[model samples]
Target chain A: MKNFWVTLGALVAVGLAVALACYRWHCDEPLHAAARQRDALAWLTAEYHLRPEQAAAIGRLHAAYALRCAEHCMAIGEARGAVAQAEREGRPASELAAARDRVAARERVCREAIELHLREVASQMSPEDGARYLGEFLPRVAAYRHEGAPTVRLNQ
Target chain B: MMNHTNDPFSEALADWRVNPPRDPSFRAGVWARVEALRREPWAAYVRRHALTSGLALLAVVAVGGWVGMRQAHARADRDRALLVQVYLSEIDSRLVATDGTP
Candidate 1:
């Protein structure tokens, strides 16, 4: 009976340890977005065979671009909120139209920021890699994302 | 039958077999001692089966480690696929057609 308990305890301990190990294998929901960006950057660096210096520079560029992207996204979100509020209050059509225009402008800014980031990343690579990045890789990446939006709809 | 009157060893053996210990509680005392010896300590029980238990523990660790590693590898592959899905969605037809053209 004592041996049974001891063996059972050991088995439970091992089961918990294995469970924890498996849990760590997944990127958490909030971390998933960041992981995707990091993995994408890592893939690019590896595929291009970038030098340390080039990678570092491109990393900085990516960071800057991310900041700009965030700012644009925030603006778009704020405009959408304002539009919703205006609609709720039964505001003038002109006011809603202006809010819609504001949202559109922010979206355009975000797209341009993404484009500049791509250009900067490509420029940091070797000429051959840069051309392929701009031509093949960037196109494939864009086509999959549907006009540079995230997989999940931001508004929805 | 050849009877020898000078055989003292046989006589002593017969006497000892016929005349046992005179203590009234001798059998009870012997049984008590036997019971005490029969009860084993917990540590002794573990020591006796240490080899088997150790082998079982080793097997558990090996199987757990293998399963954990396999699960982690599978999750990593799935994560990589998701990252690729996110990345490749941005590509356009024109950009793909112009491979390596600056």
Candidate 2:
């Protein structure tokens, strides 16, 4: 009886610890949002030379990229869930393999889509604007903006 | 060749040991510089830049804060990634130990 109680207490403690651990580790929302914000600023800075219409188009492209990322995550979830289900039911190996392959294909498609979007963003910009991108825009939109930190003076 | 050389090493040693300059102006110049430095506090000279110590300190603190924030973010990124990796690895290890990797 004592061993049973001890084991029960340990399990409860461990379960609570795990719950807290997951809560603490959950940085997905904030980190990903920060990345998206930087990406938006990058787009904004890169298209200063372009017409507003062109800039608006890039904004549309950003919205699409966000959607694609969500789709990619969903695909991974679907694949992982199917695999888990297959393991539970002792399902056939080929079926599991196919699910994994489908997820892999979706992942590739997402990467290609992003690359193509970058190409479009670049092609729409003037050469000078493009250079500004390489020289300044890429460095400034960081969380800390290291490369563009203005020089400091004592009086001002 | 003069074979009767009187200990050339000793002569060379004596030549090197000769006393330094007898004129006192050199020491006076050093004292003069010391007097000049004493007459002018560094704050006056440094004031040309119009930089107050407090302002300099604030600037340092501000830049330091920015740098610290950047470092913290980088460390947070690394630590976050490591946390995810460790969590995944723990799950993997438990599954492997339980023979549940199928």
Candidate 3:
């Protein structure tokens, strides 16, 4: 009976070790690799199978657009703030409408800029991939609410 | 010469006899009990053949773990793809800074 218990315990331990190993190597490995990547550029290069030159070109475009994007973000923030302030102060209907229009206009401009930037990035890829990239991204830009950075929901 | 018919004690001894009660299934009952005793209980069997039982259990565990690993790997591949998409979107939008800036 004692020997039986010992053997049962050992088997249980072996089962646990096997489970842990599977989780680490198979379940967690890919996410870990994704985490180890430097940024989106690396992800793009890998996913799209971009040539080195293509990746380099896209990288330059991204760097230049980043500054413009920040400026747009600030402008949009200010526009939203104006709308908020107007609402808080119980401003005239016309004043509130104007503030709201300003926010919408700023968001429109930001979306247009993003669309153009995406086009430029896509142009750096191969023809088929470029079209696919645009197809994937254009609708997202159009639908963006400017609430925060867009994210892909993994669970979905 | 001493065993003559006139001895009453000898006559009584000769008349003494016994008749047991009848049991038709007694033989069958006894054989059934014998079979039960011959069969080994499962726990004792396993204990007696510990090495073989352990090896069988290990094999089962190994196969189950392998299948689980395959499923996990497939799921991870999908998650990796989604993560790549998220990374690109987060960078391109710039509404929320990846660098923790406003």
**Individual DockQ of the candidates?**
0.07, 0.01, 0.15
Report the C-alpha lDDT of model 2 over A1-156, residue by residue, as the tens digit.
343344345445554555445444543444444333433333243335557777777667666666655655566566566667777888788987886676556545544554465556656678777565444322222222222212221112
Docking class of 2: incorrect
Best by TM-score: 3
lDDT of 1 at A97: 98
lDDT of 3 at B97: 28
Model 3 C-alpha lDDT per residue in residues A5-75, reported as the tens digit of each score: 65677667777677667766666642545545535676677667799999999989988988887887778
Judged by DockQ cut-offs, the docking class of candidate 1 is incorrect
lDDT digits (tens) for residues A38-110 of candidate 1: 4665666665778889989988886676566656655667777777787888999999899878766765665
True contacts kept of 3: 0.24
Better of 1 and 3 by TM-score: 3
When sorted by lDDT, best at the front, the candidate numbers are 3, 1, 2
Please write out the lDDT profile of model 1 over residues B32-68, one tens digit for every residue: 9777645655556567778877777677777776777
Preferred candidate (lDDT higher): 1 or 3: 3
Error of 1 at A72 (Å): 1.5
Candidate 1 chain B weakest lDDT stretch, 10 residues: B92-101
For model 3, how does the per-residue alpha-carbon lDDT over B3-96 read when each residue is reduced to its tens digit? 6587888888889997889999999999997776457565775787888887868785896588668778777666555664565455443354
TM-score for candidate 2, residues paired by index: 0.35
